[model samples]
Target: MDRERLIRYLSLLVIGVAAVLPFVLEANLYLLNVLILMLIFIIFSSSWNLLAYSGQGSLGHAAFFGIGGYASTLIAVQSGLSPYVTIFLGGAIAAGIGVLIGLTCVRLKEWFLAMVTFGFAIIVQAITVSFLASLTGGWDGIASPRLVSSQVPGYILIEYYSILAITAGVILLIYLIFKSKIGMAFLAIRENEIEARVSGVDPVRYKLLAFAISAGLAGVAGALEIHYFGYITPEIYGIDISFWPIIYTILGGLGTIAGPVVGTVVLTILWDGLKVFGLTYERYIIIGAILILSVIFLPKGLVSLPDKIAGWWKRRQKKSPDAGT
Candidate 1:
C-alpha cells in the first residue's frame, strides 16, 4: 500500500483502540485519569508542534496554558457559565495575548525567540501571583468546577469520554489545518522566510496567526486540565508544564501531526511505569537519558523508527548478497 494509505489505516486503528480503551481497562478510575491527562497533553503537545511548524520555538508555552486555565476558571466562577463554555472563551483570551506576543517574536528566530517566550511565562506567573492574586488567589490557588460533577453516576467515565472526544476533535482540526493552504504557507515560512515573502506569503501575518491558533489550542488543553482536577494555581504556569510539550513533540517527531500523540503516549507510559518501581527523582534522570539517546540515534523521533529499521534491514540484505558473492 502507499504511504498515505498506510498512514490513514494506522490512524483509524489508533482511534479505534482509543475508543475501546475504557472497556478494555474496565473503567478503572486511576487509569482513566491517566488517560485523560495523557489526552490533554496530546492537545498541548500538538499545539507546541504547530508553533514549531511555523519555525517558532517557544520556551514559555505555560504562559498560554496558565492563562487559559485561569481565564476559564475565573469566568466560570463569576459568570456562572459552564466550564465547557468558559474553556473556549479562555482560549480566545489566550489567542489575543498570543498575537501580541507574536508581534515581538516574528522578527526573532531560534533561541532568541525561545528566551523571549520563556521570559513571558515568568512574567505571567509573577503577575498571576502578585498582581492578579485577588482573583487568582495567589499561590494558594482557587477551586474550579469539574467538567462533570462527581455527584453524577460514573462521572469519571463521563469525564474520560468527554476529554477523549475533545482530544479527537482538536487533532482533527489540526489535521485539517495542516492540510490546508495556510499549512503550505507555514511550511514555506519555516523553510525560508525570505523565499516565502518573495513568493507572496507574508511571514509576519502567518506567524501571528500561527501563534494565535497554537496558543488558543493550548489554552483549551489547560482549561480541560484544571477543570478535570477541580483546581487552579499559579503552579499551572510552572517551568515543567512548559517543557513537557516540547519534550513530547521532540520525542515523537517535530512538525508532524501524529508525532505529538505518539510521543506523549510513549513517554507517559514510560513515566508512569517507572513510578511503579518507586523511582521519583531518578525517573527524570532516566527519561533524560532516553531522550538523549533517541536524539542521537533517531533524530526524526520515534515516528521515524520504523522507516529507519526498514532501511537498515534492506542495507544488510544487500551487504549479505555481496558477502556471499
Candidate 2:
C-alpha cells in the first residue's frame, strides 16, 4: 500500500485505541485525568500549530485559552445554561479578541509581533484580576460547570468519549481546511507575502481568519479543561499554558496536521515518566535539550525521523556498492 494509506490506517488505529482506552483501564481516576489533560493539550497545540502554519506565531495563546474558559464559565453560571452550550459562545468571544489582536499585529515584524502577542496575555490577566474583578473573582477565579456531572453513573467514561470525539472533530476540521483554498493562501502567504499579494491572495484577510480560527479553537480547549476541573483561575493564562503548545507543536512537526497530536502525546509521556524519577526543573531542561537536538538533527521534527533514517541507509548502501567496485 501507499504511504498515505498507511498513515490513514495508523491514525484510525490510534484513535480507536484512545476511544476504548477509558473502558479498557476501567476509568482509573488518575489515568482518566491524565488522558483528559492530554486531549486538552492536543487541541491546544493543534490550534497553535494552525496559527503558526499561517505564518503567525502567538506567544500568548493562553490569553484566548483563558478567555474561553472564563467566558464559558460566566455564561453557564449567569444564564443557567449547560456548559456544553456556552462553550461555543466562549470560543466566539475569543475569536473576536483574536481578530482585534491580529489587526494590530498583522503589519509588525516577527519579533515585534511576538512581543505584542506575548504582552496581550499579561494584559488580559491584569484586567481579569483588577478591572473585571467583580465578575472574574479577581485572582480567586470562578467555578465552571462540569460537562458531565459526577452524579452520572459512568460520567468519567462519558466525559472521556465526549472529549475524544471533540479532538477528532477538530482535527478533521483542520485537515479539511488544509485541503481547501484558504489553506493554499496561508501557505503562499507564509512563503512570501509580497508574492502572495501579487497573486491575488490578501494576506490581511487570511491572517485575520487564521487568528480567529486558531484562537477560537484554543478557547474551546481551555473551556474543556476548565469545565473538567470545575474551576478557573488567572493562572490559566500563565506562561506555562502558552509554552506547552509551542513545545508540543514544534517537537511534533511545525505546520503539519499530525505534528501537534504526535508531539503532545510523546511529550506528555516523557514528562510523566520522568516525574517518577522526581525531577522538576530538570524535566524542562531535558525538554529544552531535546528541542535543541531536534532543531539541529530533525529539523522537520520527530515525524520525519523515519524518512531521515531511510535516506541515511540508502546513502550508505550506495557508498558500499561503489567501494566494492
Candidate 3:
C-alpha cells in the first residue's frame, strides 16, 4: 500500500513535469504540435475509458467525435463564432446523439453493444458524405477557425497553453466523476447487471449518462483536433479513431484513472520513436505483439506492472531464504 502511494505520487510528479514541459522545450512548434495531438488523444481515450468502465464499451466513438467536429466546425463557420464557445455546443450535440444511441442499447451487453456502436460510426459517416454532403462539403472537407489566429506572435505557445488548460479540466472532471455515485453505478453495472438492479441502481440511466459524457468529450477532442488543423472532413469518423482509445485504455490499465494517461504516454513515445527509425507498418506489428503480451501476462494492464514486479521480487526473496543457502 505504501508502495502504491509512492507510485501515485510519482505519477503526479510526472504530470507536473508534463504541465511545464513545453516551456522548457522553448515551445518548438513541431514538438508542441505533437504534444497537442497527444493531449487531445489523452482526453479522447480517457472518455472511452470512462464508458468501458461502465460496462458499455463503444467501438464507434468516432461517430460522436466526428459529430462534435462537424457540429462545432459548421457552427463556427456559419456564425463566425469562436471555436471556444462552439466546442461546448459541439459537445452538447454529441451528447444528445449519444443519449439517443444509448436508448437503443439499454438492454445490450458486450458483443452486441460493440457491434451496434461499430455500425453507428459507419452509419454516421454515410450520412455525412451523402445526406449532408452539401453542408459537410462531401469528401473535400472545410476550413475551421484556429483556436488562436496564426497571425499572433507566439500563437503556437498560446495554443499549446490553451489546450493544456482544456485537457487538465477534462481530466479533473473525469476524476471527479469516477469518485462520485455515478461512477459507482457504472462499476456496479459493469460488474453485474442483475446485482446492480437488485441494489436499486438503474443501469439504463447511468449507461446513457456515461454514453453522453463519453461522446460529448470525444466530440470536444475531435473538434479541438480539426480546429487545430483548421479543417474538417468526414474522414474524422474513421474506425482507427475509435480503436486507438480502446487500445490505449487496455494497454494502460482499464477502470483506473491513471491507465489512459500512462498508456497514451508510453504508446505515443513508442509510436514516434518507431517512426524515427522508419519502421512504418512494423511499428504496429510490434505494438500488437506488446498488446498480446500485456493481456496474457499483465491482465491488469501496464499500470499494475510495478506492483507485479514487486510482488515477484518479494516471492523470490522468500524462496531464497527458505533454500538455506
Candidate 4:
C-alpha cells in the first residue's frame, strides 16, 4: 500500500481503538480518567506542534491554557451557560489574546520569542492571582462545573466518550489545516522567511494566524481539563503545564500530525507505569534520560523510528554480500 493510504488506515485504527477502549476496560473509572486526561493533553500537544510548524516555539503556552480555563469557568458561573458552550467562548478569548501576543513575536525568533512567551505566562499568572483575584479567587482557586455531573449514571463513561469525540474532531480539523494552502505557507516560512516573502507568502499574517489557532485549541484543551477536574487554579499556569506539550511534541515528531498523539501516549504510559513501581521522583530522571537519548539518536522523534530501522536493515543487507566476498 502507498504511504498515504497506510497512514489513513492507521489513523482509523487508532481512533477505533480509542472508541472501544472504555468498553474493553469494562468502564473502569480510573483508566477512563487517565484516558480522558491523555486525550486533553493530546489536544494541548497538537496545538503546540501547530505553532512550531509555523517556525515559532513557545515556552509559555500555559498562559493560554490557564486563560481558557479561567475564562470558561467564569463565563459558566456568571452566565449559567453549559460548560460545553463556555469552552468554545473561552477559546475565542484565548485566540484574541494570542493574536496580541503574536504581534510582539512576529519579528522575533527562537530563544528571544520563547523568553517573551515564557514571560507572558508568568505575567498572566501574577495577574490572575493578584489583579483578578476577586473573580478568580486568588491563590485559593475557584470551583468549576464538571463536563457531565457525577450525579448522572455512568458519568465517567459519558465523559470519556465525549472527550474522545472532541479529540477526534480536533485531530480532523488540524489535519485539514495541515493539508491546505495555509500549511504550505507555514512550511515555506519556516524554511526561509525571506524566500517565502519573495514568493508572496505573508509571514506576518500567517504567523499571527498560527498563533490564534494554536492558542484557541490549547484553550479548549485547558477548558476540558478544568471542567473534568471541577476546579481551576493559578496552578493551571504552572511551568510544568507549559513544558509538557513541548516535551510531548519533541519526543513524538515535531512536524507530523501523529507525532503528538504517539508521543503523549508513550510518555503517559511510561510515566504512570513507573509510578506503579514506586519510582516517584526517579521517574523524571528516567524520562529525562530517554528524551536526551531520543534527541541524539532519534531526533526526528519516535514517529521516524520505523523508517530509521528499515533503512539500517537495508544497509546491513547490502553489506552482507560484500562480507562473504
Candidate 5:
C-alpha cells in the first residue's frame, strides 16, 4: 500500500481504539470531565484551524460561537424543542451570520480584517448583554435546562463515549474535506490570493463558504457545551472565550491536522494538573509560554516536530552507519 493509505488506516485504527477506551478503563468522574472538555476544545480548535489554514485570521469568531450557544439553549428551553434539533438550528443561524459578514469583508487585508471581525464579536457580546432583556436574559445570559441528570457512572461513561463519537465524526468530516478538491482550493487561496484569483478561483465565494462553515461548526461546539454543562451565560460568549481557541490552535500547530489535538491534550493536562497546586488561574501563563516557545522553536507547531526529527535522524544514519563497523 502507498504511504497515504497506510497512514490513514493507522490513524483510523488509533481513533477506533480511543472510541472504546472508556469501556476498558476504570470510570472516574474527574477523568470524565477532562474527556468532555477535551472533546469541546477538539471541536473548537479544529474549526478554527479551518479558517486559520485558509489564511483568514479571524479574531471575532466568538460572535458565531456565542450566537450558536444562545440560540440552541433558547430554542430548547423556550420554544420547547429537542436539544438535538436546536443544536443544528443554532449552527445554521451562526453560519448565516458568518456568510453575511464574510461577504462584507472578504476584500480586507488580514490584520485589518481581523480587527473588523473583532469589532463584530464585541458587538454581538454587547447585544447579548443589552436591551434584548427578554430574549437574552440581559447581562446575565440565559440558563439552560439540564440535558442529562443523575450523573451516574454509567451515564458518565455514556457521555464520554458520545463525545468521542461526535469528535470522531467531526474529525473525519474535516479530514475528508481537506482531502478533496475544495481543500486544495482553500490552500491555494491561503498561499496566494492574487494568484488564485488570476487562475480563476473565486476568492469571495470560498472565503464566505469557509467563514460560514467555520462558524457553524463552532456553533455546534457551543451548543453541545450548553447541553453538556446544563448552563449558559453571557460571560461564556465574551472575548475571553476566543483566547482558548487561538491558544489551542497556535500551540498545537497553526495548519497541521494533528496540531489541535496535541495542543488540546497538552494544555488540558497542564490546566487540570495545576489545579491541584492552587495555580488554576495561572493556566494562561503556561499556555502563553507554550505558544511563545512553539512560535520561536517550532513555528509550524508540534505536528511538524516528528517529521523534522525523522529527517534529521535519517541524515545522521546515512553519515555514520559504518562507524560501528
Candidate 6:
C-alpha cells in the first residue's frame, strides 16, 4: 500500500480494536452486536463504492449480499462446515455470479444498465421466496447455523479479534486496489465512458472485473451478517439492502476512501440511539432529511464537510485576522 493508505489501514485497525475492546474486557453483548453490524455495513458500503466509483451503477447489489448469506449459512448448517471455509465459498459464489452479470450488462449505457441490475435483484429475491423447500427458505427464511455453538464460549475475544482482523484486511485490500493501475483506469472510465472506449480501453473487461470485486466484497459482508446474526431471510436479498450501500456511500462522501466508513459509523449510531425512543421508522425519516440537506448543502457528502469548513475558516482568517487583535 501507498503511504497514505498504509496510514489509513493502520488507523482503521486501531479504531476497530478500540471499538471491540468493550467486549474483550466485559463481554458487553449489546456493544459487540452493534459493532458487528457497523463493520458489516462498512464492508458492504466500501465494496459498493468500488463499483460506483468505476461508473457502474448497479441496483442489484443485494443480490450478491443475499447469495453470500445463503451460501455460507447453508454450508455451515447443512454440511456442518467450518465458518472460515464458508466465508470464502460465499465470496467466490457471488464473484462468479457477478462476473456473469457484469459481462452481460457492462456493454450497456446509463439507465439500461441500472434497470437491468435492478431487474436481476428482483429476480433473485423472487427465486429465494419461491424455493422454500430447497435452496432458499422462501418467505419464512431460515435460522442460521451457529458459528460459536457453545454457551460458555471461551474464545469470544478471539472471535472479536478475528472479525477485526478480517475487516482490516478487507479495507487494506480495497486501498491497494484503489491505488493500483487498474483503479486509475476505472476512474478514467467513470469520468467519461465514451472517451475511455475511444482511448482503446476495453470497457467490458475492466467493468466486469470491478463488478466481480465489488460483488465479492458484498458477499463477505453477507457472510459476516449470517454468522453474526445467525439468520437468513428473503428480506436479506431485497432491493432495500442493496440501496444501503448507496445511501451510506452518499452520506459519507463519494469518491473518497474513508467516506463510507465514516457514514456507516455515524448513521449506525444514530439509528441505534433512535431505536430506544421507540421511533424506529423515524430513523429513516431522519436519514432522509439528512440526505436531502446533504444534497442541498454538501453535495460531495459529510467527508467534504471538513474541507468546506476548513476553507471557510481560512478565508475568514485572511479577511479579518487583525480585527479582534
- Each model's TM-score? 0.97, 0.96, 0.95, 0.98, 0.91, 0.90
lDDT agreement with native, every candidate? 0.94, 0.92, 0.90, 0.95, 0.80, 0.82
Model 3 lDDT at residue 12: 73
Error of 3 at 182 (Å): 0.8
Give candidate 6 regions above 4 Å deviation. Answer: 1-20, 23-25, 152-156, 198-200, 321-325
Query: Residue 36's C-alpha lDDT in candidate 4?
Result: 92
Model 3 lDDT per residue over 1-325, tens place: 9976886688578778878898798877777888889889999999999999899889999999899999999999999999999998998999999999999987898999999999999999999999999999999988899988999998877877788888878988998898899999999999999999999998889999999999999989988998899998888999998899999998999988889988998899889888899998899999999999999999999999988999998888878956545
Per-residue CA lDDT of model 4 for 1-325, tens digit only, reads 5999999999999999999898899988788878999999999999999999999999999999999999999999999999989999998999999999999999999999999999999999999999899999999999999999899998888888888888999999899999999999999999999999999999999999999999999999999999999999899999999999999999999999999999999999998889899997799999999999999999999999999999999889888876545
Question: Whole-model lDDT for model 3 versus the true structure?
Answer: 0.90
lDDT of 1 by residue, 238-308 (tens): 99999999999999999999999999999999999999999999999999999999999999999999999
Output candidate 6 Cα RMSD: 2.7
Residues 8-87 of candidate 2: C-alpha lDDT, one tens digit per residue: 89889999999888879888998899899999999999999999998998999999999999999999999999888888
Error of 6 at 125 (Å): 1.3
Clashing pairs in 1: none
Overall local distance difference test of candidate 5:
0.80
RMSD of each: 1.5, 1.7, 1.9, 1.5, 2.2, 2.7
Model 6, range 1-325, lDDT digits (tens) per residue? 4966776676767676666576475877777778767878888999899898899888889999988888888877778898777987898888889999888787787799889988888888887777544766678788886556547465455556666667777877888888897898798899998798898877778899999999998988888888777788888877789898888888899877888888888888888888888896778898799889988998898988877999999889889959556
Residues 197-246, candidate 5: write the lDDT tens digits. Answer: 89888888888888888888888888878878877877766776777888
Task: Tell me how candidate 6 scores on lDDT.
Answer: 0.82
Answer with 3 or 4, whichever has the higher lDDT: 4
Query: Once superposed on the true structure, which residue ranges of model 2 sit more than 4 Å away at CA?
Result: 321-325
By TM-score, the better pick of 1 and 3 is 1
